[model samples]
Every structure is written in structure tokens, then in C-alpha cells.
Target: MQTNQTYDLLTQVQRIASGDESAFASLFYQFGPRLHSYLTGITKSETAEEELVQNTFIRLAASFPVDRNSKSFRLDLPGGQQ
Candidate 1:
């Protein structure tokens, strides 16, 4: 079951890397609620959670050609810092 879910997520990430808007939307809908809940718990602020979620997706979309080979998630930080 975990393997299947991982494969499916990889597929979605690949599609997203190819600039498929709907794939990105699908991922957003799939994880949005859970991400919101987690963020809310960590930040204890609905507004912050919402903003963080939005920023996260924006970063994901902006980081194209998602590296499937890399085990660690990487988002290019501000000021060109990795």
C-alpha cells in the first residue's frame, strides 16, 4: 500500500515537472487539508498556516523538473541560497 502511494505521488511529481497544471492542482487538493492541519498545529495560527501552505505550493511549482533521484526535498531559498 505504501509502495503504491509512493508510486502515485512520484507520477504526480513527474507530471508536475512537465508543467501539467492539473497535476499540480491534483497534488494540492490531495495534500492541502493534511498540510493545513499540520501547519496549524505547528504555527498555532490559521492565517500563518494558510499563507505557508500557499507559499509551499508556489515553491513547489516554481521548482521545476522535480528531482526524483534526490531523497531530500530542496527548495531554493531567497537570495539564491540553496
Candidate 2:
């Protein structure tokens, strides 16, 4: 059974896939900071972290309308394996 938060995220992803800019903004504001922190820890550079996070969202914007048959959504990193 999905929890409220999971359902909410799925709704947001669906909105984002439909080109809902406000939903994009909402998800960004909701997850960006924590994503940044995690990236910063791994890369150890603020510049890289910022770039990475931006690239992430860019990929997200283009790669949505997700595949329902897939058990999970994939976010490919720069020059990284798909």
C-alpha cells in the first residue's frame, strides 16, 4: 500500500510529466536542498553539486511521462550509465 507521501510524489511526477511548471517548482522546492546536500557530500564541490542538481532536473523535465511497467523511475547522471 502506498503512503500519503508516496501518492503525493506520484501525483507530482504525473503533473511534471504533463508540463506543469508549478508542480516542477513545487518538487524542486521540496527536494532540491536535500539533493544538493547529498551531491555536495559525494562531489565535495559546491559548483559541481549545483551543476549536478540542475542537470538532474533538466533530465527529469525531458525524461518524464514515465514508464509504468518499470518498477522504478530512472535518473541518469552525466556521462553515467542509464
Candidate 3:
């Protein structure tokens, strides 16, 4: 069950890499709130959190690739790899 979910997620990533805006939006919706919370916790600034979250998604979209090995896929941060 858990593995199936992971597989589905990887498929979504591939779709995103293929220029699927809806897939990317889904990714944003799924991860955005948690990411925002994490950024807010670290910086303790709402504005910074908003900026960082936006930056994160932009970077993610730019870095996306169809053939990427999903098992190793991760979001990188401007502050550094995270």
C-alpha cells in the first residue's frame, strides 16, 4: 500500500517533468502547506516563508526531468540542499 502510493507519486513527478501544469499544481497543493510551515518554523517570518515556498516550487519545476530516478528525487533549497 505504501509502496503503491510512492509509485503513484513518482508517476506524478514524471508527468510534471513532461510539462503537465496540473501535475505540478497537484504537487504544490500536496506539499505547499507543509513546506510553508517548515519554512515559517525555521525563519519565524511569514514573509520569508511565503517567498521560500514560492522559490522552492519554481526551482522544483525548473529542475524537473522525465527520466529522473524518483527514489532519489528531492527538493533542493536555496539556503542549501535539504
Candidate 4:
């Protein structure tokens, strides 16, 4: 079950790399709230959480390649990528 979940996540990421807006939006919708909550907990500021979440996604998008060769990849965001 866990492995299947991981595979699904990778597929979503691949869709993102392929310039799928819906896929990116899905990722945002799926992860954004959790990320915001976690960030707010750590920073104790709503504004900071918002900024961190944006920065994290920006960094992830910037760092990832369109033609990634690896089947599995990990991105190390500052507060993590949700």
C-alpha cells in the first residue's frame, strides 16, 4: 500500500515535470494545507508560513529537471515540501 502510494506520487511528479498545470495544481491542493499547518506551527506566523510554502515550491520547481532520469527523486526543501 505504501509502495503504491509512493508510485502514485512519482507519477504525479512526472506529470508536473511534463508541464501539466492540473498536476501541479493537484499537488498544491493536496499538500498546501498540510504544509501551511506545519510551517505555521514552526514559525508561529501565518505570513511566514505562506512565504515558506511559496519558496519551497519555487525551489522545487526550479531544481527539478523536465527530463529527470531517476524513477524516484527527493527534494530537500527548507521546511520540507509538505
Q: What lDDT would each prediction earn against the true structure?
A: 0.73, 0.73, 0.74, 0.72
Candidate 4's residue-wise lDDT over 10-33, tens digit each? 999888786665666678778878
lDDT of 3 by residue, 16-62 (tens): 77666677778888888899887876999888887888888877777
lDDT of 3 at 55: 84
List, residue by residue over 19-80, the lDDT tens digit for candidate 2: 56677778877888889989876999988887888788777767777556544443443333
TM value for model 1: 0.73
Give lDDT for model 4. 0.72
Q: In candidate 2, which residue pairs get closer than 3 Å at backbone N, Cα or C atoms, i.e. clash? A: none
TM-scores for the candidates: 0.73, 0.72, 0.74, 0.74
Give the winner by lDDT: 1 or 4: 1
Q: Write down the lDDT that model 1 would get.
A: 0.73
Query: What is candidate 1's lDDT per residue for 18-82, written digit by digit as tens?
Result: 65667777888888788988987799988888788878877777778655564434343232223
Residue clash pairs of candidate 3: none
The reply for model 2, stretches above 4 Å from the true place, is 66-82
After best superposition, candidate 1 residue 75: deviation in angstroms? Answer: 16
Query: Considering lDDT, which of the candidate structures 3 and 4 is the better prediction for this target?
Result: 3
Q: Is candidate 2 or candidate 3 better by TM-score?
A: 3
